[model samples]
Target: MSIQIGQALPDLDVDVVEDGAPARRMSTASLLGQGRVVLFAVPGAFTPTCSDHHLPGYVQHFEAFRELGVGVVGMAVNDVYVMQAWAAVQQVPPGMKLLADGNGGFARALGLEFDGTAYGMGLRARRFALYAEDGVVRQLHVEAPGEFRVSTAEAVLQALKAPEAGTTG
Candidate 1:
């Protein structure tokens, strides 16, 4: 089963890419364990929807998330190098992080991995987003296959602003 509200995120190692380099390897617990965070995952970096909409939406609203005291992170099953290049091309803001989950380990751990062999893309993450506070999940939005709506930055932001926003989608 997929991770649910009130469960702590899995403490797996993920590489944080910065300035076209692998900055560090840290456990998810350390990276997202202390504060409010919005972690969004793409099927693959540089893919159509991810490049055109998903990533840009977060980039555009990076400041808004920060203003709410929530750190924004983008993750993909690609390696650190690909993640670095994508980050550079997208002009991702300094505070935001791009994670390299090269082996799809993290996605699998969350029960969010999808086989894309038919598409020639191998194993990849599903399009999803989660809101966590001090390591425990508060909300999760996993998009339906080939669809995008609930996981958008706007949707997450709206949920965050709601008085009772614990529901998952």
Candidate 2:
């Protein structure tokens, strides 16, 4: 089942690229516990939509997301090495974390995993963006296949400004 809105995030242990070359495990609690955060998931690290638009949209709006008091992160089912390479190739923005779900461990935990073997891509994450505060899901925007509307940086920024939205940090 898909993760429901208002549920606390599942236990997710993902690998994150640190500095420029090294990677380390990061827990969901550690990443989302201290503040409002935006975690956007893509199918793969270097796929056309992901590389051309999905990831870049977040990177380009990193400053704006931060200005609204949100920590922005990109999550994919790719390994850390591929994630890091894709980030570099895209000219990753400073302060944005490009996190790898590795074996889709985190994505599976969140019930967001999908088999892409028909396309020969193996396991992958569904496209979605989640907003959390203190680890509880505050808002979730999931996209239909081949659609890219709700997870854009602009949409997230507008949501953050919603009078009735946001989680107390």
Candidate 3:
């Protein structure tokens, strides 16, 4: 089944690249367990939308997300090495994390995987962003096909500052 708000995130093993550490493979649960997290998925690592606006939005708002006690993770279906290179190219800020779901297992498990065969990319994750606290989704924003709204860090920050956001815990 597709992951839903109030549902616990699957314990999927995703490859993460952290600063000052070797590439480590870990479960989503463990990563989210650290604190509230804002996880965003893109269709591809270095696509136009992803490069010009998507990642830059998050990069611009990383400190705001951190100030609100939220960890940011940018996930894609690319390999770990590619993710690392993209991060370096994008100059991802300190507060955000990058994860590689190379095989699309993570996206598939979330029911968010879509065929990118037509675009010459095998399987790509749909553009979406989710908020999880201790691995349970609190507020999720899944973009409509080829749309980009409500998934940006700015939106997540606004949601996090809402009156009822406290009860999400």
Cα lDDT listed for each candidate: 0.90, 0.82, 0.84
Give the per-residue lDDT digits (tens) of candidate 1, residues 1-169: 8888889899999999755555689999988899999999999999999999999999999999999999998999999888988999999988899989999999999998999999999999999999999999989889989988888999899989982766555
Error of 3 at 120 (Å): 0.7
Put down candidate 3 lDDT per residue, 1-169, tens digits, no spaces: 5688888888878999767356799998888765789989999999999988998899899898888888999999999998988888888876568989999999998888899999899999888888888888888778888888778777778878882542221
Residue 142 error, candidate 3, Å: 0.3
Q: Candidate 3's C-alpha lDDT?
A: 0.84
- List model 2 lDDT by residue over 1-169, tens digit each: 8777678888767788644657778787787666889989999988888888988888888888888888988899998889889888888777788788889888888887889999998999988888888788888888777788877777777877883643321
On a 0 to 1 TM-score scale, where does candidate 2 land against the true structure?
Answer: 0.91
Q: How large an RMSD does model 3 have?
A: 2.9
Candidate 2 Cα outliers beyond 4 Å, as residue runs: 18-21, 163-169
Per-candidate clashes come to 0, 0, 0
TM-score list, all predictions: 0.96, 0.91, 0.92
- Ranking of all predicted structures according to TM-score, beginning with the best and ending with the worst: 1, 3, 2
* CA error at residue 74 for candidate 1, angstroms: 0.6
Worst 10 residues of 1 by lDDT: 160-169
Decreasing lDDT order of the candidates: 1, 3, 2
User: Where is model 1 more than 4 Å wrong at Cα?
Assistant: 19-21
